[model samples]
Target: MSSPDPAARPGHAPPLRVLILEDSRFDAELLTETLDRTYAAIETTIVQDEQAFVQALAHDRFDVILSDFELPGFSGGQALELARKAVPSVPFIFVSGVIGEDNAVELLKRGATDYVSKGRLARLPLVLERALKEAADRRTLGIAEHRLRDAHAAADRIESRRMALIELSDHIRDMDDPAAMAYMAAQMLGRQLGVDRAGYGVVDTVAETIVIERDWNAPGVHSLAGVMRFRDYGSYIEDLKHGVTVAFADAREDPRTHATAAALEAIRARAVVNMPMTEQGGLVGLLYLNHGEVRPWPSDELEFVRDVGDRLRSAIARREAQIALTAFAASLERQVEARAAELEAAKEQLRQSQKLEAVGQLTGGLAHDFNNLLAAISGSLELMRRRGPLARPGDLERYIGVAQGATQRAAALTHRLLAFSRRQTLEPRHLDLNELIHGMEDLIRRTVGPEITLDVHAAPGLWSAHVDAGQFENSLLNLCINARDAMPGGGRLVIETANLSLDAQAARAADLSPGAYVSICVRDSGVGMSEEVAQRAFDPFFTTKPLGMGTGLGLSMIYGFAKQSGGRVGIRSKVGEGTTVTIELPRSEMPAEAQATQPQGLEPAPRAPAGETVLVVDDEAALRMLIVEVMQELGYATLEAGNGAEALRWLHSGRQIDLLITDVGLPGGMNGRQVADAARTGRPQLKVLFITGYAESVVLGQGSFDRDMHVMTKPFEMHALARRVKDLIDGP
Candidate 1:
């Protein structure tokens, strides 16, 4: 290693010290001669052996060392290694005549500065020049690297300050609470960034006076709230006057400054930046940033402070708006909740109303069927009694009387059922109650039987009530028969019709619509009903009669009918005292519509003629046999097939069948409808009759029967079945 040659700079002081090791004395002297001629300030030391090389290195400092590859006691590689340990920065070179390119190149890798060949001594001065130049370059690099590391550290500090400013601005912008937002922004600038004191003051721009809103001073600093003024005689006034941010990089000696120097000194604040919060070119407030130590503010950082002031102004205003919106949303939610609750209540009321209406409809339908049956029984009995001698025979009269008593009791129960069902059809007609009762007298007498005495009590000129004549008669007859049933043995049955007006409270107590009405009452002495029986007596099929003798539908049907007709049906009974049923019809305000024209009489059914092939297909063999017998009696050729499959097979066989009578529900893989379908394939013009003990109406769509096809419920009378089939087969 060596210093730059002083002589190379011309008038430089001395020769740099240089060391040379060579196997050949000629090469060593050659290098020394080159240095001596090219550099006026050349100093040279020559070592040719390992011992000399070691001694020379420990004893001297040289500018550079020149070594030969082949030596007496050491190779150039060995000497080079020893030389670098003693002077790590010193330059070394190889001078060798036997050194091929490979060995010369290998020696240079061992930290040799340069290489010279004995045959190339003319280039020795050039090699010496380069070695010295390289030594200076290495030293220069060390100094440059040191300065580069310092520059990087300074750059990181600048970036960190920039990032902190950005984050502080973001924090202030995001604040939603007005007071809290100002306080937090002040704290971040004062505490986190080592400011001595920080505060925000709101100014009434019109009044131009500072109102200290939020402030934070470093530990042991006194409050500065009222001490600062915005109008006059203060440093903040200068900031307000300019409407521009003011920076005091060093607050120690400013002429425009007032007591702030002493105040900052008291708080140990060395510098300050006053950022003005302005909007629309007018100052609104001031955000003061104070530093605890003397530090210069970077331009970017000073700029960021102004941005934060702008954001703070917007944040406070926006927060107030947000609070207003929240209140409005809450009020809207309450209104919606109230409306939803109201709607739910209305829906419940509607459901209850619909339920009542459906119950009324069911009641009306059941009552219609019940009243028809009563009419048939009463009419038949009345005709028979009128033509009979049994009325005079005491024993026969007693039997008749017992039957009549039971019938009256049953009818009474039905009246109550019709009432509950709300189907009591009240016709507002100008009709005398006495006349109506008189018209039903014959039927009532027969229905009550000879054992049960029939009594009619009619109020004179009994008020004409608006009511269905047919339903009224049926209601009366139902009461009579129910009375008769209650008195299994002979008993007295009485019927009465009168006029009455009901009051509102009475109507409500009975759950009836308030109206005026006429009343018909039927009383009988028979086995009466208990409280439990009376309560559910109007429920369909709730009967105490033997299973085969009574269907509980009687009373429920009557109760439903009574209600539907705009009337009230009432019942009274004691377990052993018999019962009385009363029906009240609303008094007539409008006349009832005249009855529609009806067929004068049911046409006598045409008979199934002899030689007519009537197919009877039924799953039940007994039913099939009975049907066959009926068909034969009617002078028809009867063909019987058990089950739908057998029936279908018979029809497919091309049998001459005129009418197909089949039970709806069948076994053996086919139902009556399927059989009929298959039969129609063979006999396109075949007429089919479907019989069902269950609900055939359901299996057949509502009124789905064709004009030529008929449906008959099972357990029908033999004559009725024959007649229905014949009428269907004969009529269009």
Candidate 2:
């Protein structure tokens, strides 16, 4: 304030603002004109009374104050006191004729800057110049003192916090118990930081959970001491996981906490600071400060908090390491050598046993399921054979039917296992699940049992998915049956369909790519599963049902099917809250085709036409011979090949082959696909039928080869293969 006013510069200088308290307008104008001689420009305000003078001083800033000693009701002495209170830093001068030198010196001692007598009006310029400069000096000195006080206060605060942290470090360094150290650190932080509560929480990054045992709290404040799923609070937990210090001034105002602001207020955490502690490349713990009032967290406060947190971590570790060392030293001579030897041997045996156990569990479960199916097939076949010539009328056919039924079930089991491995052959169709669910509603109700309630919530304008229809239906039925079993006393089962557009955040959470997807969610209101059960639900051979009641492969098969179809599956279950299994598949761009209805009657397969030559290729000698024999019985001339090379040789021989039948997986130099590609070079219009167990065979029917190509999985009935061959060769 002591420096010259910025507005009073050399060029284009502002007017010297002066307030005049005089009854005579003429004297005021003469006074202003007198000061204008010393200053380039002077602006004057003339007040005739005490009220006007006080209002002018309050409403404006002036460089100088000029008052007449005599006023109608107010004296210059009285005006001086008011001016000293209103603008103490501005110069006050009296330009009065009646004021004597003795009186003037007395007034000057009373804080008046200068006096200019009416008798000597020309000396006014010199008097006014000195008054303004002296006022500027006093103003400058006042500001410097104010700044010095602030700097000293800040330094004191910093030193206080630093000493507090050092003392806390010393206290925690000697404490052997981690809990005691943590609690003491929390208390010191809460008091030093002026917060309502301070605490440290143990983190479990693997489970994405946090647990608090104890914390320091102010009077009447409750502690958040227990296991917690931070996800229930808000999105800021992710920041904590990344070792970021999350600070929010107000829970209600921050976007991250807005959804649960009321819940935050309940814990007196209207504002918060979460300092994450990370170790071994993962979040290990959290040091938190909470308050009921919202306040700005400055950079210095945050840095100070981080320093304290680091010191706390080091001191806690040192104490714990000391304790460990003491315990190790006390027992060193007694058991160290023998214990070490025993531990090594036990570890090696444990590792070997673990490997054997895992292998045995998987193989044993698979063999058990397969043996059951094989027994049914082998039993039915031997019974029919033993009946031989003594067969009752219509008995052989019935026996054959039993064997066929068992064989079909065996094939289904193989497909389910393949699905669980994500290797099942798929015939993906563009399907609107709304229509599919509607069609299956009756069957699903019956399968779940008459006691269970079924509701299908098919969203309008649902996107279609490109997936294997048969696999999708099987997965759905498996889910429904599981739901039914969960609720022994029947409950509501909801099948919900919806379209979702996931962004990167949500997609990462769901372990999927960011894009549009169609989701089918099956939710059951029944006796729900625990966290442990829900986690292993997708593991093959891990089921919870009683013996002979369920094959744990159902969920795993559904999981594999979803993944193989460029999708994801997730499950959520809480005790007494029921379970929900959700499958999210990528939305298909193509239009959905209407499902074809099955006919009530059967039609026999057509025989091969004249000049229809069919080539049969397979790696299995028995399977190839069977197919060749079936072709022979159908009156089709066939060339049998044991491998891809042998089949290509026949095709390249310029023979008139009407259709080529090749197994997708073959030994020797090439597979069926390669063999077809080689032969198609000369015969581009060659009709081919691919028999595969791999869904990669989708390339033929659903993708690139949209014409003159077909596919069927292995282990098909001879009659079905016969019809397919005839249709490809003789029909369109």
> Judged by lDDT against the true structure, how good is candidate 2?
0.84
Name the lDDT value of residue 510 in candidate 1: 70
Q: Top TM-score: which candidate number? A: 2
- Estimate, for each residue in 1-732, the C-alpha lDDT of model 1 and write its tens digit: 223455467866667688878666666666777776777676778777889889989988888887777777578888888987999889887777877888767766777788878788888788877888988898899888888777666655555555665676577667766767777767766654566787888777556677775588888775666634443433556556557667766656555554556666555555777777776677777888776667777775665566556666778766766687578667656766877655665566568668776666556645655565555555555545444554546645565665555455545454444445442223234666687677778878887788988888898756666555666666677667777888878988888878776689988887677877878888888888898888767766556887457656656656666666567677888899888888877776655344443335455535655577888988787778877887787688878888876786778877788888988888777888788877777787899888875434334643245545667654565766766777666776
**In order, what is each prediction's RMSD in angstroms?**
42.9, 35.8
TM-score of every prediction relative to native: 0.29, 0.51
The list of candidate 2 runs beyond 4 A from truth reads 1-356, 600-602, 609-611, 696-707, 730-732
- Candidate lDDT scores, in order, read 0.70, 0.84
Name model 1 segments beyond 4 Å from true. 1-440, 449-478, 485-531, 538-610, 650-655, 668-670, 673-685, 699-704, 717-720
Q: Write the per-residue lDDT of candidate 2 for residues 1-732, one digit (tens) a residue.
A: 112345666686677788889998778777766766666666778889988888998899898888999899889999999999998989999999999989999999999999988989988878877888888888888888898778667766886886788788778767777878889888988888889999988888777788899999999898888998776667898888777789999998999898988888888998999999877667888888999988778877888889878987777666766687567656653555647655665566568668778667777888888888777776776676556669985888887887788788778777777898888887789999899999999999889887888988999999999988888999999999999989999889999999999999999999999999999999999999999999989977888998988777899899999998889899999989899999999999999989977535556757776847899999888899999998988788989899987887898898888888988878776888888888888998899889886666433533446368778897898888887887677655
